[model samples]
Target: MDHNNMITKFDESKYLISMAPVEKVLEAGYYLNLNDQSNVLDLCCGYGEMLKLWGEAYGINGKGVDICDEFIKKGNERLEQSNLNHKIDLVCQDVKEFKTDEQYDVACLIGEVIFGDVSGTIQALDPFLKEGGKIVIGEPYYKQKDVPQALIEFEGDLLTLEGLYDTFKRSGYYVSYMAGCTDNEWERYISWSARRDLEWLRSHPKDKGFDNKEKWIDTWYKMYFNYRRPYEGWALFILEKI
Candidate 1:
């Protein structure tokens, strides 16, 4: 069914992939006090919207890596249109294998922990961060401990806010700042994503993956609406290496 391709199609034209509100994203950059001299690295940088916004806001230079070719292409187009291609570099590659010799003033893994574990991902990213640099992570936390088993399986070892903080602290990082998504914001994101998928499904009824796409959309909508929306809390955490 080319599930990856279908998902990419569903996400077409969207900017931010995470549950974070656009204002929250801008607030994160402001909280970090990023300047023109700041160099940023964004892993799993979907469509490069956050980096582009930061570049325009703070004049920061950034490098973004994502595995989606369509997203990278769109990001490049946006950069070129904004005359920001020289300021920001967008590459299509799996972040786990993305290598860079230079260190960054800021590194981010927004809503994606491709390294399979949050602590492990942070450890892997540590070498790319310059001294005193900040790392930003956008992740979902369990709102309560007694979530459904299916939801828990979908989320994979999520923790409470306190646990998330302790994880960073134990990993030798300090939590400098955090911004959480409002319930309204989370609902809007999920609803919008599901709507987009439904719209695509309606328009592509004759496509080879039609049945699979429809099933995927229905299942995803049910899972998110019935479980994630009520039990999951999403947040952006800014950490500094201690």
Candidate 2:
């Protein structure tokens, strides 16, 4: 399996699971903060969709930064369409290396975390928060024996929601808001997921094949089941720094 091709095929699900439906995630963040007006920092913001949604729908504006140039370009175009080019700032650079002079009321990472080094991941956001500001992290939790060996070996470190919460606590942050998937509407927003998986399987033809692959998919789906899945997958935690 060509890793690059796998990424290309999986981009949609990556976007779907991690990026799509930013409007609802943004609303959740806003509701958690109890404000319609607040500065937002969308770190790891691929294409700035969240910023565009917030600006266009709720009249809020913020900054979005990502490591990918294509994402930044698309994000700029989206902002332009929303006529929010001036309201939102888009940066095409490693967010960890980027610095903002402005302090934000809220910060969000509505995609995958626990990739790369776990402690380093949390520490990277240290400079972005304003005093009393809250950080919202969208995490996928699950139950059963769903965690994949591939994810642990290839993707990055995997942590349960409880583990993540405890990590934040140890970092002097308190969990303030947690949102679990309840509407069964998550699937409605993710039609492209099958395409992504198929592409991955095609790119990575192997003897191990669909047996392991189906298990991989099932692992995530099992996460959706509240009882069988670990602490429930797709949870958003709002944390305030102590």
Using lDDT as the measure, the top candidate is 1
lDDT score of residue 18 within candidate 2:
54
lDDT of each: 0.85, 0.64
74-166, model 2: which lDDT tens digit per residue?
A: 779767876888878888887667786888777777655533443455566656767787776766544333565544454245567667767
Output the number of the TM-score-best candidate.
1
Q: Pairs clashing in candidate 1?
A: none
True-vs-predicted CA distance for residue 29, candidate 2, Å: 3.4
The 10-residue segment of model 1 with minimum total lDDT is 5-14
Question: RMSD to the native, candidate 1?
Answer: 6.6
Candidate 1 at 51: error in angstroms? Answer: 0.5
Count of backbone clashes for each model? 0, 5
Model 1 over residues 1-242: C-alpha lDDT tens digits? 89996674344425777777666777899999988999999999988988988887789999999999988999999888888999999999989899889999999998876787779878977889989988999878998878899997777779888888888988899988898888777877777777878888889889998888888877887888899888889899999965
